[model samples]
Target: MTDYAIGDLQGCHAEFVELLERIDFAPARDRLWLAGDLVNRGPDSLACLREVRALGNAAFTILGNHDLHLLAVARGGARLNRKDTLDDILAAPDREALLDWLQSRPLLVRQAFDAGGDTVMVHAGLLPQWSADEAAGLAGEVEARLGSERSGAFLEQMYGNEPACWQASLDGIDRLRVIVNVLTRMRFIDADGCLDFSAKEGLDSAPAGFAPWFRYPRRDDLRLVFGHWAALQGRAEGARVRAEATDTGCVWGGNLTALNLDTGERIGVSSHLRR
Candidate 1:
């Protein structure tokens, strides 16, 4: 069975479909891992959500910033920004089922296969201090609440940048909020692993004390699979650690990317729709 992971869909349904056809993706045997951001900013959020949800057991996805944004908006936790393409998804007939399925996806995923050893996937990179199991445990807290009706309360508390450092002693919504942001919204961080939320520019030079989260030496254990920083362009491979940026900005006039985990082979499907 082949295992493939793709970058942010950003609601680019046309490109997503084309990528599947290019690979001749067989849902019965091949496994697909989506790096999240399944909706928003592209032309067809509703269609993208429905198609992926229809994939059922063939798909394995984790939460991304856009996915959380949709959840937060649905909970009335946040207001929709002008660039957001979520309105179409929110107004769809399958809105409830789609959102329900989306919300149920994990903040992090850890899978052990014969060739890749232990693999951990999250939307953004991880702090050096966290192992996969440790991250998974923290993610479980938010996942449990999200699986319940009380999720709105959690999503409302989810948006912020306080208590800015990781502490095992942190509890309640404040603690969980920090965890979710690190796992989803994080990109650059300081030597201390504290997040630098202000930088969006794609440059080799970081602002003062900050560095890309993956550059830190602490991630020496499992192989990390992540997207979200389109600025990185594509894959940043390290000895045992890596960042796979599948969201090559298909919605932003770039191609969609997929990586074959077993061979480290990459496949791209252009956004032009007609391949």
Candidate 2:
């Protein structure tokens, strides 16, 4: 009956399992909130996807940039990069089911707490211009098209960083692309709500015009939970929003983190890799 929010898996299946064990997670009773990137860059992409998919209703996962990239590559819209370890997933016997499950995941996850407020989880971060409600609506827009006939054409259009800001008037691929970026890859956002893609370090190293997303005015209206910034190592400021960055860089030999939703308690387990 407990809920735990986990950081990126990134194909580190062993660490993922160990973290579950450490937390004494029960697949039948405990619900897991995964912060995305369920596959890629580590030893067992297929295993990670299958394990999470096996959780059924017990797990709620969002789509990370890597997850979308896998979809694009599977649909023939993109090539497997040199560093990608996703071939096993693409070649698996249950590839269709796995891909379908992954594709069906939402871009935004909303859970109501007992204290009368709720938390919204996205893979990366939200734009300053968006309220949690607006962002959830926008996420549904991408979810609708991600696995449809239009996705083949839109997947190719999904790669760019152009139109780096969100606009109500944005139409077609431009709008979807911006939504995907902010939800999956954003780290810093300018005061005007423009995304900054260059820097990956912490807030102190922010580029001249940008600041971390949680620091923006009124961002605490809805509590935000996110992953994808390994540099943060499970730490994000802005207590008002309870902003939590759970990606502890397990794929890079750091630990995997899980947060207790009701208690706001965080626990970490080291990566299985000897690195």
Name the candidate that leads on TM-score: 2
Candidate 2 C-alpha lDDT tens digits along 1-275: 88899989999999888899999999888999999999889899999998999888999999999999998899747999999999999999999889888888999999788852678899998876888789999999999888574447777778788989888899898999899999999988887889888898876878998888877866446768899999888888653355878899999899999998888888999888766
Instruction: Provide TM-scores for the models.
Output: 0.94, 0.95
Model 1, span 83-175: residue lDDT tens = 998988888788888888998999888898788878888898788888877889888988988888554777777878887787888888778
Candidate lDDT scores, in order, read: 0.82, 0.87
Each prediction's total of clashing residue pairs, residues at least 3 apart in sequence or on different chains, is: 1, 0
